[model samples]
Target: MMPLATVAALSAALLALMAQASVIGDDGRQTADREALPLASIGSLLDLDSGALCTASIVADDLLLTPAHCALRAATDADCAWPRTRSDCREPGALSLRDLRFVPADDHQIAPADKFAHSRRIDRVVAHGAASADYRQQRHNDWALLQLAEPLAVQRHPPLRVAVPDYATIGGTALAMPGYSADRYYRDGNPVADVACTLGFVAAPVSLIEHDCDSTAGASGSPILIRDGDGGWSLIGLHSDGPDPRYARSRNGEHRNYGTPSSAFWPALMQLQRQRSLQPPQATDSRR
Candidate 1:
């Protein structure tokens, strides 16, 4: 058997690889190398796909942090938030209620045996008080918090820790994400149908860097994660949007993408924490 230190080092390297992402499958599924990753890598795959295709990070045992735009479900005629037609209350490009679900990392793409098969619904979405205003003024600052109806069992998987201004250090670190796309299965050449994970870089604060990390419409909110010491993970950013073909071709057909950095706004996150704390305990069901 390998020495304990050697084994530990090997494990760390494998975990780091998973932190980098793969391409999305055509069916909006992922082809993750499960055997190479730790349970924690699996924990990061919480499916918080509310209406707008976005990604999220598990900040706490039961809480997830994501973009407000992703969870801001557009009110429809069937479920009107205002009397003046559900369409009136909606923004230009908003997601409807039918396109959202929260599946744990392990059960997200490839369903586990029996205990983890189907994706679960998000119990409630807690958008920051100023999310709408901030999103309008600065699209990159749009962020929110989510309360999973059932607490995930990530005690075994090293959970991610929230960071503030340290995002600048992300430049050279490795990153990854497994996300869904328009097509539900994996495909080659087609950006829309591939669900994959690839190695990426945490650029300054604006764009999370990557050479092969091409993303499409369905990957708007994919979590960009980086591994720290002791297998700990930190969310560097999320896949926001990709560069235009003109921009890419102009720059020698290079692949470049951007994400809303977590460091960009702290008030939004704090607001989420406060809201989560104030929620009535009885209103939720524990999934311990």
Candidate 2:
């Protein structure tokens, strides 16, 4: 964990790009080992064709959560906004299941040929707000859910518990964020984790959480976690790039990262589970 005092000591190099950074003060991220329970729950969401990647974590036996933007078509300079719907903004069934994959515990710096064996296919995507051109305008509503083709093995990697009652008590609490940041990432894949960071604030008006953890592009859908009573970790928020474009100017006087609170997504998740219960059973791939 980087000292809290370092956050205010800005350098000339960082001052120029303060508003565009995901890291504050100095880089405090380190490579993490996913050989155990909680850490093993972290994985990478990949677009098999374009090779784009975003960090994700398992939240249920067969369900994982990621940023809604990760499910959209890649942005273009000509993408629409506001009054005009963004040209590539997503609609239901807009994604290709064949190309969308969730690779479990993708911490191998050099991947093995058995990559496909552990990779899971996304069978359904339930997004809250990625259907408009102005998707970037509301970064707080940027979460999405992905249902896997089959349930994950419980012994090696268990789904993380959402921080519900604990979230109400997170004032000034320390946090940890682990994900697949793209900057130093190589072909085989390695996850970087920022520990002992704290949230800047939890704004009730926007249902958003602001933090000082260091992360990057591939870490967009990473989980902002807190320690639980049982000495385990729980998910509290979903990390996004930063803030909406219009709100970027007001930084509260520090380099802060933004995310949607679980309060905003928990209800929708309950609904998704109910819907899934009614659906007929489907066949799953048996490669792995």
Candidate 3:
């Protein structure tokens, strides 16, 4: 008995609601409300070469944690020039540090008028010794550290503390994964997040932790966080890769994400923090 015009309008509204619900069931929400504080520590890593972007977390005033592959030329090619030693990777022009920018709390604003006071150029990059040119090695040594040209003012954007949750404690625990995903496609480049993911399991040999968090290409170094009882969040790992295509479809039909456990790189992080603390303050750049 409804008029034709009214019926059409109601159908459109119903379709819109269904579309929104589908997105929610697929990738989770944008996570702005539940993770505002922790979001401040997350950012985007822009590779000038291929125009590729990845996620990263600020763990210290001058240090960032991300995946090793983000800094490599051909990360998955085993035949590519791999940094076999510390000296090889640290030498001047050994690895590409030029044109690499870290934008903390990046909301993906590309407008000329947008304020980007928190973005900084990378001064140095260090990957774990185990990281190699082979794709197979990725799961084992996917971690990397990025040192900024100058320390970010911690008062404005606080750094996250890395922690390795006990294996028993992590099983069935809820986690939040925040990142700047390529598919999110915001005109302003705002980061998206999955706030209700869970740690499915851990692969001890490769030090890989698997989770049900929804992620995409640009989320390579996104942080996996666990909330504490005292209302604080701790960094547990850095997202590295998604499940194999064959095995992926079976796990909730969403990508099964993986990350390198924070405990694997705790010693290196501590050493870097100590060295950073010992360094004298340098002049601040006004152009940044």
TM-score result, candidate 2? 0.73
- What is the Å distance of residue 30 in model 3 from its true position? 2.0
* Error at 246, model 1, angstroms: 7.4
Q: What does candidate 2's lDDT look like per residue over 65-126, in tens digits?
A: 88777765544333345553544455443432325777787335434334545668887765
Give all candidate RMSDs, comma-separated: 12.0, 9.5, 10.7
Which clashing pairs does model 2 show? 86-133
Give the poorly placed runs of model 1, Cα more than 4 Å off: 1-30, 35-54, 81-99, 108-117, 128-139, 156-158, 170-172, 181-212, 229-231, 246-253, 274-288
lDDT of 1 by residue, 1-288 (tens): 444335334433543343223332222234444443332432322222222234556666666666555655555555544433455445654444333455445544452222124555566655532333432223355556666767776664345665565544533345555454433322221112122334444443333334244454455556665666767555655565555443331123444455566665456666767877898877555775
What is the Å distance of residue 42 in model 1 from its true position? 6.1
Stretches of candidate 3 above 4 Å error?
1-25, 34-37, 74-98, 106-118, 127-129, 132-137, 165-169, 246-255, 277-288
The TM-score measured for candidate 3 stands at: 0.73
User: Which ten residues in a row are the worst by lDDT in model 1?
Assistant: 185-194
lDDT tens digits, residue span 69-132, model 3: 7765532223234553343444443444434678777444564123234457888775453645
- TM-score, every prediction: 0.57, 0.73, 0.73
**lDDT at position 104, candidate 3:** 74
What is the C-alpha local distance difference test score of each model?
0.47, 0.67, 0.66
